[model samples]
Target: MAFHEMLAPDYIFESSWEVCNKVGGIYTVLSTRVRTLLNLFKKDKIFFIGPFLHKKESNIEFIESETILDSWRKYANEQEGLKVRVGYWNIPGKPITILVDFLPFYEEKDIIYFQMWEKYHIDSTVAYGDYDDSCMFAYATSKVIESLYHFLQLQGKKVIAHLNEWMLGMAVLYIHKYLPTVATLFTTHATSIGRSICANNKPLYGQLSNYNGDQMASELNIKGKHTLEKLAAFYANCFTTVSEITGKECTQLLEKKPDIIIPNGFDSDFVPKGKMFETKKVKARSVLINVIQKLIGLSIPENAFLLATAGRYEYKNKGIDVFIETIYRLKKTYFDRPIIAFVLVPACLQGARADLKERLENAVSSQFPLPRPFITHELVGPLCNDPICEYLYYLNFTNEDDSQVKIIFVPSYLNGEDGIFNMVYYDLLIGMDLTVFPSYYEPWGYTPLESIAFHIPTITTNLTGFGIWAKSKGAKSDTLDLGVAVVERTDDNYFETAEAIKNIIVKYITKYDSSQILNIQRTSCALSKKAFWSHFIKYYLQAYDVALRKL
Candidate 1:
């Protein structure tokens, strides 16, 4: 049969821990793809299943709709004794969502685990921490799916339960056993062993081809999670991953070659256009400058370059160490222009600094150096314990008089109430002159894509899926001329990566004229257009076809 001429699902039920929770990159994957799904199927035909902690907690992302799926909601609750709330996810698509309360399933966790082991050979007895919660949620989600399938009287109808990550793996297993008619697709954003190897400071890319996934999982003490992820990949009708890099990891670490590669795509509706874009950029730059000057008690130059590296505070994995190293190198080698770099990585932090808050409010500048001068927020523990803070102190990248490259650590989530900028991340991202994400271990980088979407040229490593995609589309070197610099980053090239980034920044700040810089920004914006959901949604259609064909 031709690939394009395969069966399509009548009802699509997608589940993720980050459906409306907004935890990490997975949230970006599911939320952004909603509109495309809605365009393919009617709003009522698409359903999103997520874990429901509380109404108060999820009120921001979910709007309870008492009318939609009213019959199945009641049936799942009364007959199945399941707790579920049907609603609409508060995104652009506003698709139907069912947030299932999984707390009740914890009481029968043993039976659930036993059934999983007996049927699918998934061992959950050694699982700890969030495993129980995730499994219970998966069990609840499966019950919801089964109840809905029977209640709707669609026994043989084409239904797909697409689950994301190992957290929702049990849902695939449950559907495989109980609702065998439902086609299942499982996508692992990053395998447990691959992440563990990187976290342990081991060389992942250099030695990836020779590693045994099960052995490495035991060594890393992640056997339970790895087993579940492996089982899901093995049992699902179609197992998939986010990017080509992650597909290789799945093949080596999980021992299962993916049936398809569904790279993540975004909706560009959030990006401002024309004058609005310029206005937003100006406002963001103003806000960023004000915050930095207040925190550092120094008047930054008018032509200072505002650079940033933002994401989760994975010091080594996200290449935060390399970012700091590049800044230090820039300071030591080239001080021709003033550069202010923001490490917008959220860490375990206390609230905003009291003294800094007072200084900002009172418009006072301290002549003496403040404790942890480069950091905006107070650390929860001793400053020496945090890797980034410790490294900054060791390198003396303190925003003192002699240092031309000033670094500010914004160690709080930018959710419009971080007590510092009080602005969301995107509101601040537009202000950046250049963004860098030299990730040592990124499955699919959203930060660099976001930076380019804002018309800001960015530098990322070739290890990332997005970087590889950019390279395929003519990103040749670590220079602003390409708009997106896909720096060659192997496991052993830490210092080399830092040097390459330093040179890129030096070239951009010194050599590029205003018109040239504007052209680079235009190139970045053009590259972002190629990654929109409209261009990338066909890969998802292909994945669905693969799953249905397998069924």
Candidate 2:
């Protein structure tokens, strides 16, 4: 069958734990894709369902809309005792949203789990932590969908309930059992087994083909979550993944092949351009330099290169180890300019350091180093326990008087209120001369894409989906000539990966001229254009088509 001939959904409903909640990369996927979806479907035809929390305590990303779905809202409340708030997401799309209050469903948790086991074989009896909360919310979302389908009296209209990640996979099973006519699509951003294996220091990519997912899940004590995910993938009308790399992981780890690959894409509407971009970059650099100077008590060189690596604090999975190794190697090389690297990954921080705050407020520049000179915030635990800090201490890159390479750990979320920089992540990201994310287990790296979106060249390993995509489009690994360096990496090639990154940084600092650097920056921006949602939304349409056809 021709791809274009597939049926299109009249009403599309997307459910996720990250919806209206900025937790991780899946939030980026759903929020960024909204504008494109809004353009295709009517504003009322699209709905994003998420768990509702108290408005005062939650960082709510939704604006309540009482009039939009008033009729269905009343019907659901009166008939099914379903409590939901209709709203518009405060994003580029401003699409209609339904935040369901799942607290009422807590009493029915055991019954819901039993039904799940009987209908779909999802075992949640041994589930703990986020299992109960996510399942309750998913159950609430399913009720909301059923109410809407009935209230609207649309028995035959094409509808899609797309659930993202394992947290929301219960909704797919719910729809499969109750509303069989509603086409269901489940997208597992990353399999539980795959991530667990990586976190446990197991060789995932190297031994992927040989490993039995169920055996690994049982061994890792993640069988419950893995079973739920596996069943969702098996039962969904169309099972999709965010990247080709994750597609392979899903096939092996979940025991199911993805119906289609819907790669994550960036929306460039948030990025600044022209003189505005330059102005933001200047402000960002000033903020970064000021904070570092206050903490380390030394004014860095004017031409010092600013670099960073930011994401969830997954040391090995995100390649913080290799990043530190590369920085250590770069310190021993003969480079004239100083390099200041920021490890922007959030960790357990006890607010900003009192001494650092006092220095920033007083604008004092003391010659003596602070207690922990390289770390910006006071850790909640012993400083010796942090892998990145411990590794830096082991390597002796402690921002000493004679050290050319300075590493500062900003272990707080950059939400314009990190006390020191007082700048959001994107604000600080634009000031970077380069970014490095040589990840060992990245599905679709958003940091490198965000770097290139800001027109900063980056170094990432081919193990990442973005790196492979960039290489297929003629990206070079050893040079910043093509904007992104795609380093070849494997389970056993840790030192080689580190050495490759070190060589690239050395080349950029020693060989590239000012004009050449400008060219690389421009090339990075051009490559980012290829990843815009305008170009990648077709893959999602394909997935939607497959789901509808399955109905």
lDDT of each: 0.88, 0.88
In model 2, pairs of residues that clash are none
Tell me the tens digit of each residue's lDDT in model 2 across 359-478: 989988777778789999888889889898899889987788777888988999998898888888999999999999989888898889999999999999898989988998889878
Flag regions of model 1 displaced more than 4 Å: 1-4, 55-58, 363-369
Whole-model lDDT for model 2 versus the true structure? 0.88
Native-referenced Cα lDDT, model 1: 0.88
TM-score of each: 0.97, 0.97
For candidate 1, give the lDDT of residue 526. Answer: 91
